[model samples]
Target: MTRTDELIALEDKYGAHNYHPLPVVLEKGDGVFVWDVEGKKYYDFLSAYSAVNQGHCHPHLVETMTKQAQKLTLTSRAFYNAELGKFDKFMSEYFAFDKVLPMNSGAEAVETALKLCRKWGHEVKGVNPAAGKIIVCDQNFHGRTTTIISFSSDPDAKDGYGPYTPGFEVIPYNDLAALKNALKDEEVIGFMVEPIQGEAGVMVPDADYIPKAAQMCKDANVLFIADEVQTGIARTGSLLAVCGNCSCENKCERQESYTRPDILILGKALSGGMYPVSAVLADDDIMLTIRPGQHGSTFGGNPVAAQVAIAALEVVSDENLAQNARKLGEMFRSEMQRIIDSSDLVTKVRGKGLLNAIVINDTPDSKTAWNICVKLAENGLLAKPTHGNIIRFAPPLVMTEEQLMDCVSIIEKTLSEF
Candidate 1:
């Protein structure tokens, strides 16, 4: 057989069946395109679920990661490393928080944020320690950790995850009334949500949903925790989706329209797809509750992660990624609307920034979206289905108008075939 077939067989033989990946085997990636093992080039429309926002193998991130790796890599949290302190200060100030808790991955950061909220709830909110409950919205995709999946509404991700951890209340997403009703519980700790439900087919809530929910949280003495793992770091046309309507160069000052969070969870592009890095940020009042020995990760703030993160963040502003996302997102949506209005295959296009999706006019359980994705892969663009019939179309923020238009052409061509 061919090399592609060989590689696929090896994976099928050795790897677990946890993921149902597309058939193409990518070997190299640049700004907006990736080459498969067979030397065919394709646009990477998914951007590794927004992890490679700065683009694959970004020179700056690669250089920083390489230089740091040559000097030092890991120095467990026991002994303070040189890079960690600088990273901490930079992250706290950059994100407009008093302190930051570094972690390894997005899931770890979510768990860290949950732990922080619970601890703060017990200590500051005066909630009974054992009864502390965090409010999570349905259709949220935090991660695969046991605690993270405990309250998941997705049967594929949540089923048989054992007697799931308790203390989590599920509410409908983007529903301020549901949030208001839930916050009335004395046992509630915080309301955690994603500004845009990326994994849930890039679901953008109502224009005022976040700002209103944040205010409700504040009025009820509840902490508004934002899980920006998927939607943060310039992914949603803004520095953070919560930083609504304000495209500030420095993401510190809060706009009246912005929905500032008490606890901000960030990851993915934080390391520019170079290293696994994530962080949870909060003010001193709430952050200080997690005293030493309460929680820690071995590879959380290693030298390489610190350096890579700093460099990655630098690229977001220096390269004007957020503004680019905003401009291109509008263009993308407008083009998509034109396609939708003319065709019956796609029902709608919805999203903010480069993070967007097209709803297929087929049953959720049908393979139409997956089949379209396969055709997209064959037509020199690669995208994937998030849910059953909703295909996410997030490309790297680094893409230019020319490249985006080319991708749109390819998408149009492929859909016409379908």
Candidate 2:
């Protein structure tokens, strides 16, 4: 058997079948490209679910990680590390949050945010400690954690997770009316949402959805929690998805459209896909609700993660990745629209910045999108289908205009086959 086939067989025999990943055994990656075990290169349109926003093995991140690894890796939170303090202070100021709670993964950061919100609700908002409620948008993809999947509308993710955690209300996404009504419930403590729903087919909300939702939460004393794990860090053309249309390279609170979340949960690209790094940010009033012993993780704030994240964030700013994503995203959507105008297979293309998706005209249960992705892979681009019929295309932000056009051409050619 070939090397690729042998590796695939090994995984099938040993690994859990939890993921149905694209049938490509990647061996190496750089920038927006990846090479499979067979040495064939392809554009990485998925960007490791937007974790490699700084591209694969960024030099700065690699250097930072190496240097820190040689010095110190973990201190288990039993004692403070120098890098952790620096990262905490840097991220707190960078994102304009008064405090930061570091974590190891997107799900952990999300869990941290949820815990923080609930504690704040009970201690500060006078809600019942055990019965505080949080509002979540339908079809949102925070992560696969049990508590996160508890409120999930997707059957695949939510099924068989018995006796699910309670205190969450699911509402239709982008429906301000529903959100407004949900916030009226005195039990609600926070409204947790994705600025752009990445897993649910790159669903971008209405232009005024976030700002209005934040205002509504404010009126009801409910915290607006932005789960930006997948959409943040210049993926959607801004430093944070909550920045809205602001074109600034840094913190964009000055923008009129900025919907500053009371608590911001970030992950994925925080370490530039070099390591697992995530964080929950909030003002002191909400963050201080969780005392020293309430919540912690052993490897959350390791020196390696801290330095890697610092390097990653620095890359985003230094290279102006957000601005590049903005300009290229507009061009990308326009190109897709042109293709859609002529093709019957693609019904819609929707997204912002580097994170975008195209809906196949076929039914949700159909394999057309999957087939198209396979064809795109054969043609030197790698993308994946989400929710069956929608293909998410989120290339690394470091990609240039020439490379983007090449990928667009590959996409156009592949779609023409189906």
Candidate 3:
């Protein structure tokens, strides 16, 4: 068997049948590209679900991780670590939140946010402890944990995950009326949502959707929690998608971005994909609800994660990835739209920043998008299909204008084949 075939067989024989990845055995990743086991290089279009926004193996993040590993990696929450406290302080200021709760993964951060919201609902909001509800939008991809999948609209994600978690209400996305109606419930504690639905094929809501929702939540005294694991850290043209149309050239919060969330859930790119780092941020009034022993993780605030995260955020500003994503995203959509107008393969293109997707003109269950992605892989640009017919394209933010145009050309050439 060939080297690639052998690696694929190894995964099929040993790994769980949970994920159906493209048939590419990646061996190394650089700025915006990855090399397969056979050394065939291709643009990494998915960016590890936006985790590698700062690009793969960023030198600064790698250096920080290496140095921290040699010194001290883990300390748990039993005692104060130098890196942990510094990280907490820096993130709090950077994200414009009062406090930060560190976690290991995006899902863990989501779980922490939910628990914190529920606890805050009971203690601060005076809602019935057991009945506090969190309203989420339909087609949301928060995480894979059982609790997260409980309210998922995707049957594939929810089926067989019995005894699903309760107290979550799913409303159709972008339906302000539905959200307003749901907010009428007295037991509602928070509205958890994504600024742009990354997994749901880079769904971008109406321009006013987020600002309106944030205002509504505030009017009802409910928390507006932005699940920005995919859309944050300069992935969506801005530092955070919630930052909206602001002057983020300085990466400062000087400009008004329509609305800001009370609770900010961040993960993925928090450490530039070099280490597992996630955080939930809020002000004192909301964050102080949980007592000392009520919530904690073993490696949540480890020294290694802290150092890595610090370096990662620094890279976002220093490299000016936010501006780059903005310019490249506009170019991508414009170019792809032209292709869609001329060809029957793509129905349309939609997204903000680099997190964009093209809707394949086929049924949701059709394999057209997948097959197209396979072709894209062969053409030196790798991406995957989400849901079925819709293919999300989120390249690393470190990609340059010249590189993006080359990727666009590659895509056009590949699509012309079928």
TM-score of every candidate:
0.99, 0.99, 0.99
- Summing lDDT over every window of 10 consecutive residues in candidate 2, give the lowest-scoring window: 248-257
Please write out the lDDT profile of model 2 over residues 1-418, one tens digit for every residue.
9999999999999999998987889999888889999999999999999999999988888888999999989889999888888999899889888999999999999999999999999999999988899999999888889999999999999999878999999999999999989988999999999999999999998899999999999999999999999999999998988898998744777776688999999999999999999999999999999997899999999899999999999999999999999999999999999999998989999999999999999999999899998899999999999999999999999999999999899998888777
Q: How many steric clashes does model 3 contain?
A: 0
TM-score quality measure for candidate 2: 0.99
lDDT tens digits by residue: candidate 3, 1-418: 8899999999999999999989999999999989999999999999999999999999988888999899998877899888988998999889888999999899999999999999989999999888999999899999989999999998899999989999999999999999999999999999999999999888899989999999999999999999999999999899999888665865446657736799999999998999899999999999999889999999999999999999999999998889999999999999999999999989999999999999999999999999999999999999999989999999999999899999999999999998
Q: Give candidate 3's TM-score.
A: 0.99
Question: For model 1, how does the per-residue alpha-carbon lDDT over 306-364 read when each residue is reduced to its tens digit?
Answer: 99999999999999999999999999999999999999999999999999999999999
Residue 344's lDDT within candidate 1 is: 98
Regions of candidate 1 where Cα sits further than 4 Å from its true position = 252-254
- Residue 287 alpha-carbon offset, candidate 2, angstroms: 0.4
Model 1: number of backbone collisions? 0
Superposed on all Cα atoms, model 1 deviates from the true structure by an RMSD in Å of: 0.9
